[model samples]
Target: MRNATIKDVAKHSGVSLKTVSRVINREPSVRTETRERVERSIAALHYQPDPSARSLRSTHSYAIGLVYDNPNAHYVISMQEGVLAACRERGFGLQIHPCDSSAEGLAEEIIRVSRSARLAGLVLAPPMSEQPALIACLKAADIPLVRILAASEDPADGSTCVYVNDRRAAYAVTEHLIQLGHTRIAFLWGDPHHGSSSERFMGYADALKAYGVPLNRKLVLSGQYSFDDGFRRARKLLAVKEAPTAIFGSNDEIAAGVLAAARSTGLDVPWDLSIAGFEDNPFSKQAWPALTTARQSTSEIGQHAALRLMDLLRQNRDGHTDSSVANESFVPELVVRGSTAPPRSASPRAEAPAGDTDSID
Candidate 1:
């Protein structure tokens, strides 16, 4: 037998199709007796609404797409969890898609997906979040888009955003090390193409200047955001005539690499050398001495970004195109752990020390 239709249910219940719809949607205006009668008929007939037809009629979908090209597994996992939570709470669904960050057809692929899939909006992850063409393409498609951890240069088109002040967070971490008496600190940089790379490096430099330490060109090592990258860079930095007293990795993965490098080279953490990192990833705790890093609210930021994108979609559907809701950022919190401390000795000529004894005054 064919599926029962709303018309059949209404006819069987001796009510109008509109009444059945009201009952199906649980509209408060329907009387209890009428609602009960409609529900009973609906159950008897096994009537169901076509979601696709409804979506087409309404011209709105409760589904959003998440796009990213980042390789950080921790960040990817946390972001999905956060977005999933919001979707559950709001009665929505998510579709995850990975983009090509440097491919020639990147913009075309994003634009085609946005239009073809009929997505309500998109949540962009870095370094795609910082791509100008991709952003423009999404905007041209007239879909709401939220960029996570995007730089200030991207235009704010009233789309929702969740970001961290990477520069400020980096500065704070470096300052923490500086106050602990680590004058010669080394920086393991993120991908130079990424927006966070520069922001974080600037923060490190800013802290060195504030503490009246000379900016040492030899101490700054540029590396990608990965364990292997950090490992190789750390080895190079440590090979110099006089190595740094501390090393700051762009993220926890890099920090883990640095920690590994330190161990293999016989440099004890926060004893012979200090280390710190950004983005308090799970790897931070697994290291020999837990890493002291900046805590960026990855999950919470993802949740907020999803909610904001939903709001933007609602507004756009209502014929309002206010572009003021775009452009947002989050300030990361500092989590001091066992990985960082004052230099082995405050005096440059003194022998290596032990543990994180000197607090940041």
Candidate 2:
């Protein structure tokens, strides 16, 4: 049988085509009894509306665009699933487009896609969301955009964002290590260009200060958001004369690198050194000893971001609810595992860098 149309539903329900349109679009003002009758006819006939025609008539396409660039497969997958769930609930469609802003011609690629596609709104996940030029191009296109995992510096009032308090979470994670009596904790920072990198560093510094641990610039290292990047940074930290008893990575990938470096150096995890990672990725478990980490709710963050974007699309304005944005800044749950313990009294047996082992007193 041919696909059911609006005309067929109207005839079967004994309602006008306009009334059928109202029922399908879920527009208010239709009588409850009539609406139910039209809905029943639609169900029976299996009527499907053409999104293109609907857009032409109402000038509103029930579609959102998702733009993201990140190497972590787990983070990308969770974000997609969460956004798709929200889209299904709101009777909307999603158009996924990927571009690496770090690559040449990235801005042009994004502009081409956005201008050609019919999008009511867009959602972005970093490192694409953190790209200043990409954000500018989207704004120039005059589309509403929501940024996920964005930094506080990325113009909050201009573009909507769903973010965590990175500073607070980092501080909490650091304090946990300090409380375990690990005075010499090495720090591995993520890509400095992204907003999360600096915020997390501040949190780490605040925690150390609060606990009266002497700040050591030598212990802090910066790296990109890849496992390889983590590996290099961890090596540098391990090579220090008096290596830290604990290492805090910017994210799980980096922390895993620390684990590998420690293993190669013949250090027993927790007994000789403690380790903590961010984002709580699955690889944390596969390490020699399970990793201690902060659990960032990837799926929930995606869902919340999409829901807020839908609200903006409907209202045609940034949401007036401060509580909505405030509520979105989630605190990651700290999961302590086998990777951490009180520091050993005797120094590590590994081949540590030669130095005086200067005390900070």
Candidate 3:
């Protein structure tokens, strides 16, 4: 038996070949009634469009690019899965590119890759997404882009973006610690280059202020977003004369490090010490005592970004001036786990007495 062709589907749907082509390619111009008719006819005949042949006839590329520079392997993988899901549904290909945001000629490098691949659009992750100069360069090159950013409000930079309200989520996490009777909570900050670290810090500070808890500058330490950085900072915080009973890692990796630090120092978790983290990554669950953290859906965010980029690409291709992409934002919700509890004492106490109670003052 022979396979049904586009002409056959067009005839069955009572539409022209052009209309069938538009419906098959998912162009937004097709009328709702016509699109349904084409879809039904295609389904009835089990007709499938040849992606390779369509690409050969079209000027626009069928491949989209996902560009990121992040340290977390788990996060990157999750994001990839989301983007891949969207691309697969639309019969599009995905190209994953990891690069250093600070490297010289970064814009040129991106442009070169896009030109070489004839990319349809691009999805950018933090640090890279937040860079104004890089975004300007892309815009000048007429590249359609969607950014995943961490900020309290939209930048309104004339680009499509998916904002993650890290500040709100961080505030909630800090409030939870305070409610658990932890007055002396320490904060382990992530990389400064990423805007999320700053936003999370703002949330933590705001929460402390709202609760009338004094912000102890000594308790805040800056570091990279990695398990090793978290581990090292946790050790230092634990060794302080008046150790904090509870510690908040910028993300789950750091929180897991705090757990390790507590165990190494012979301190009982949530008894002698308590720890919390942000971003409900695998580390939060796999730890001996699961981490209390915020659930940021990285996959969902990635999927949103990719879908928005595709919309922008379609609009650009159709040469319709009206913007089809809407700005989207996500706020991670708090997930209470076993890793956090009320502090053992209301007053600062020493895990190992250094005989310096004065440091608490």
Candidate 4:
């Protein structure tokens, strides 16, 4: 038996090849009735479009590339899920490339990958997305790229971007702790390479300032966006002579570490000490007592980035004069869980309150 082709689908539906191509590509110009008829023929034949054949027929490629240098596996997976959703819907393929952003040949490596893959467009994830050198290289290569970045740091010209407002989300998390009567809150920071760390720190600082809480330099500790880093930094913080009443991890991984550190020291979470985290990743919920954190939809952000990249590719292919695509931005909401609460007492050494098991949501 022979395989069915686009020609067979077109013939079965009594339509021209161009109409079949338009319908398959989901172009909006196709009439509704004609589209339904073609779809029916396609279902009857179990026909699938060949990406290689389409690439050969068109000037542009059908593959999109996602480039990132993030350390969090959960974050990477979520972003991939979102990107795949968009790619599948648009009849496009996805190629994921993880690289070192600090390498001297980073830009050259990305350019080589883009050329080799013959990608239609690219989605850049932070901190790689924030690199000026890489952006320059992509622009010089004349490649269509959309970046996912911190909302506060997006370019002024409104270039294609899916922005995550880490600063605002961080502020909300910090304010949540403050409202719980936590005056001495500590911040566990992520790697300096990531722009999100700085944005989140600014939000934490802003919340404290707004509430007239003094910013204690000793309470801020530098760490990576990982469980091990969080655990190590939190252990040291817990050992301090005047430990903070509340701890805020730059990400959920760090917050989970904080939870473990508190447990090791026989301290009760949200009773002896309160803890919070950002990015509402799985680590937040899997903890013994769920972590109070900011809920940023990483998957949605990735999907938007992919969609924006496709839009840019379409505009370029159609020779449209628009210089840039619209930007999508989101401020993560605060999800109060069991991890944070008011200090047991005004003093840091106050013992855990008796039989206190109250949790928020």
- Please, what is the TM-score per model? 0.80, 0.79, 0.89, 0.89
- Quality of model 1 by C-alpha lDDT: 0.79
- Tens-digit lDDT string for candidate 4 (1-361): 7878999999999999999988876666899999999999998998867667788888879889999888899999999999998887666889999999999989888889999988888999999888887888888888889999886545565458888888878887887888778887999999998989988998888777776678898999998998889889889989989998899999999999999999999999989899999989999999979999999999999998998888788767767876577787899999999998778755322332343311111
Q: Give a tens-digit lDDT track for model 1, residues 251-289.
A: 999999999999989987888889999988888877879
> Which ten residues in a row are the worst by lDDT in model 4?
352-361
- Supply the TM-score for candidate 2: 0.79
What TM-score would you give candidate 4 relative to the actual structure? 0.89
Candidate 3 — what's its lDDT? 0.88
Each prediction's whole-model lDDT (CA): 0.79, 0.77, 0.88, 0.86
lDDT tens digits by residue: candidate 2, 1-361: 7998888999999999989876665555699999999989988997767656666777677778888777788888888899988876555778888776578887677667766777787888877776777779777876677778744233445567887767777877887888777889889988877777877888788777766677899999878877788778777777878988899998999899888888888888889889999888887877768898888888888988888887666555323443223225666778888998889774322321334121112
Candidates sorted by TM-score, best first: 4, 3, 1, 2
Off by over 4 Å in 2: 1-57, 131-133, 151-156, 317-327, 346-361
Model 2 weakest lDDT span, ten residues long: 351-360
lDDT measured at residue 49 in model 1 versus the true structure, 0 to 100 = 62
Name the candidate, 1 or 2, with the larger lDDT value. Answer: 1
Count of clashing residue pairs in every prediction: 3, 0, 0, 0
